[model samples]
Target: MLTKDELCIQKEKPNIKDISLELYKEFSEEILFNQIFVYYFTNGTTMRIEFREWRIYHMLAIQHINGKIGKDRFFSAIENGLTLSDFTINDSIKNRYKIYKERITMFLCMYSALKEANVFYLPSGKVQNTKNAKADYIVFSEIGSKGMNIGLMKSGEVFVPMTILISKPSNKMVYLEDAIPMEVERLEIINIPIKEKEQDSEQ
Candidate 1:
């Protein structure tokens, strides 16, 4: 059951509990006592969605960006899941999702690749140091997307649950804390889409 604070939602949070529960139920029937959803956020992060029962944490980064509460088709598509807006050869628009499955997969790979490259480049810590690198640095090249940022990953820091918030409007290359769910939502049956092509155009 969800609490009042969870339901209050202040027009700022997204009420995804119902959908989450539906997913949870499906998961339970498929696999006993399984209650979790995959969550994504700005910045490079992913986490096992939990049902702690709260409103603020119930919302996803997409909902926060799009002005939560809209019946528009675009949003309806997004709420389904944040997949890239791709039209298939069959002339069908891709299923929308709150999280981009392709993006998540690529992000994991890019993160690893960046770490390895950085470690090799700055083994002396003068060029780069994963533990304590200054944000003042910038990677200048026609490399990845302009918005892609290399954030600080600390030792013993549990990061999978954190959303990767890229502060673009701030005119800075970075990913910072936008919000943290006091309680993450849980669901029974989340129809995570079939894995699509590993790449999305326009990054």
Candidate 2:
């Protein structure tokens, strides 16, 4: 069997064909996808948008999902997290996700739409990466200076699996995107509102 890297290498030229088509075609019911609205805790909405913008390593650790309706659609947060050691990214889907993941606004739209479908991901019921440059959902990452260090959200208690990364010879995370389902369950933490700004009281 070929290693993930070897399989990823074979996927350089993406074909418009996939085995999932048969399964997708067989689906009869038209399920609705909901767009989860994640109100930021400390960082605020801007911070949530930040992680959605920079596909941080931590953000990629969790499963992200999206869908469309007519010409327009939405995005949402679901409850699911994948471990680095347990993710497997398919070729075509991997490339497609990479293309879409880069677009922040659109990604959020997808995230929101997914909410309509009632999707949400809460790994171990604990969201990490609070120091994320802009905590859209609280998950973030810090690579080398010259390199692109992702800073995204931590919808809930999910960890960005090492699987969804786009492989960089210098940065191995790049090859991890495969395991990251293009339409992964959003990582939205519920019943636990993030606390912004600590109380600053002095005598």
Per-residue lDDT over 30-49 for candidate 1, one digit per residue giving the tens place of the 0 to 100 score: 32222233433244444333
Worst 10 residues of 1 by lDDT: 50-59
TM-score of each: 0.22, 0.19
Global fold similarity of model 1 (TM-score): 0.22
Please list the residue runs of candidate 2 whose C-alpha ends up more than 4 Å from where it truly belongs after superposition: 1-19, 22-32, 35-41, 46-169, 172-203
Output the lDDT of residue 195, model 2.
29
Global lDDT scores for all candidate models: 0.27, 0.25
Tens digit of per-residue lDDT, candidate 2, span 126-170: 223222223222222222221122323354442221122222346
Task: Identify the runs in model 1 with alpha carbons over 4 angstroms from their true place.
Answer: 1-64, 67-82, 86-109, 115-147, 153-203
Per-residue error for 58 in candidate 2, Å, reads 22
The candidate 2 region of ten consecutive residues with least summed lDDT is: 26-35
RMSD of 2: 17.1
Compute the lDDT of residue 19 as modeled in candidate 1.
Answer: 32
